[model samples]
Target: MRAFPAVAGNETLRNGLPGGLYSLLSHAEQYRLLCRRPDLIAPAVDELLRFWPPVVEFRRTATRDVVLAGKEIRGGDKVVVYHASANRDESVFPDPDRLDITRAPNDHVSFGFGAHFCVGARLARIQMSALIGRVVAELPGLELASDAPPKRLVSNFQNGLKELRIRWG
Candidate 1:
């Protein structure tokens, strides 16, 4: 119910939409630098999610006692998995801090892992792709209006933006 109207819903969009748009524009800048390659859109979205995932972290209760990284974890313990940090792990991604749209085998956990993965992952990607494609097509020279910085919302669960200043004609 919170996302029934993603853009129009103040309660939800206010906390997410701006940050999403900021990330989308970041991808747009990359596209422009790469000479606006049509083949890069989808890959860029994947990279963007890895680089600046909207959901910062999530928790899972250990179903059974386990050992990870040489540490013992008891059953029923709450484990806070920082998806954003995992996405940038150097072992999984070489030069993980850099945004390379062509980065394949991304294996990013932005959408969670295994059975916990988001059910809306595919749909969300499609929508984002369409929006990015449309923006590039309709506004070939879209840009930020000024040098003003993006306003961010400090959050524990989500990486959010309060507002993003932009201009395009």
Candidate 2:
């Protein structure tokens, strides 16, 4: 139907799929950090979304004048919500910078909130869960192959890893 554009689906597959993979890899990395406590794997996924979300910024338009964190914006204002900043907000997440796998009540906004939430959120989580579970189950000794850090793309919209050099057990 012309109501829904073909380009939207194409972009979703191209971007969403990779974003899920990125979240999964980050979960794998967290396993290394909390190897002693293997039980932390599940929450690590949420932690990754909070620590390093798939995208940096999203856009929205305010329909009514309101104050967000004491800042007032009039109606019909275009807003650029930064996920990276909100995820690490100290007021909301204590010890925000420190990654805690056992963190409970993780109200992360990686998959937007309210009316603008992603429709494929559940599917994406399932994919990440399966991939992360598989990697942890099959490759227990996997490690980063290179000492050099991952090369992140210089983009304002998408948060992606240009290359993730790793070694399989």
Candidate 3:
């Protein structure tokens, strides 16, 4: 009973952190920036979280009747909120498709929003920051092993890599 929350949180980090790191490595320009500027690790992590969120979407039951996007959603309705799509909203993020590590005012919904927001969001950020920083410092020559794009986990629920081959000197 007591260990359930801890295990759940660990699972989230396990799934999310690697994908975030892989996302950084896939983009050559961003990876270069991380190598050059250690200070940018935090922002880079945030941008990665926004650009390639691990959890693609989550289902929630609506508690009250509400009109969203001019569509009626009644109480007890099952709604699937796509956080990844929301993070890439053109109206919200300028040049949404581009992975800008320096993106400020980055109010991304990667860790979710409002009441549904993740309780371990801060811890996740810290862990990502440390990992990115260490990888940049230690594996300066790290790069993708193949020119071909790495395979992704084929699942509607998780946005993660099946494998990300890399080599470092």
| Top model number, lDDT | 3
By summed lDDT, the worst window of 10 consecutive residues in model 3 runs over 1-10
Q: Residue 112: error of model 1 in Å?
A: 0.4
TM-score-superior candidate, 2 or 3:
3
Ranking by TM-score: 3, 1, 2
Give model 3's TM-score versus the native structure: 0.90
As a whole number from 0 to 100, the lDDT of residue 11 in candidate 3 is 53
- The TM-score, computed over Cα atoms with residue i paired to residue i, of candidate 2 is 0.80
TM-score against truth, every candidate: 0.82, 0.80, 0.90
Alpha-carbon shift of residue 18 in model 2 (angstroms): 7.4
Q: On a 0 to 100 scale, what is the lDDT of residue 76 in model 1?
A: 100
lDDT of 1 by residue, 1-169 (tens): 3453242223223443355456656666575743367677778667777887777787789999999989999999999999778988998999998878788988988777798777677876776667666766677777666787887878787777777788876
Q: Where does candidate 2 stray beyond 4 Å?
A: 1-29, 33-40
Arrange candidates, best lDDT first.
3, 1, 2
lDDT of all the models against the reference?
0.71, 0.68, 0.84
Residue-wise lDDT of candidate 3 within 75-162, one digit each (tens)?
9999998988999999999999999898998989988888978888998999988888999999888888876667778888778777
Q: How many pairs of residues collide in model 2?
A: 0
Give the Cα-based TM-score of candidate 1 against the true structure.
Answer: 0.82
Cα lDDT tens digits, model 2, 5-91, are 352334433444445444544456556654555566567667766777777788888999999879998899999999889898888
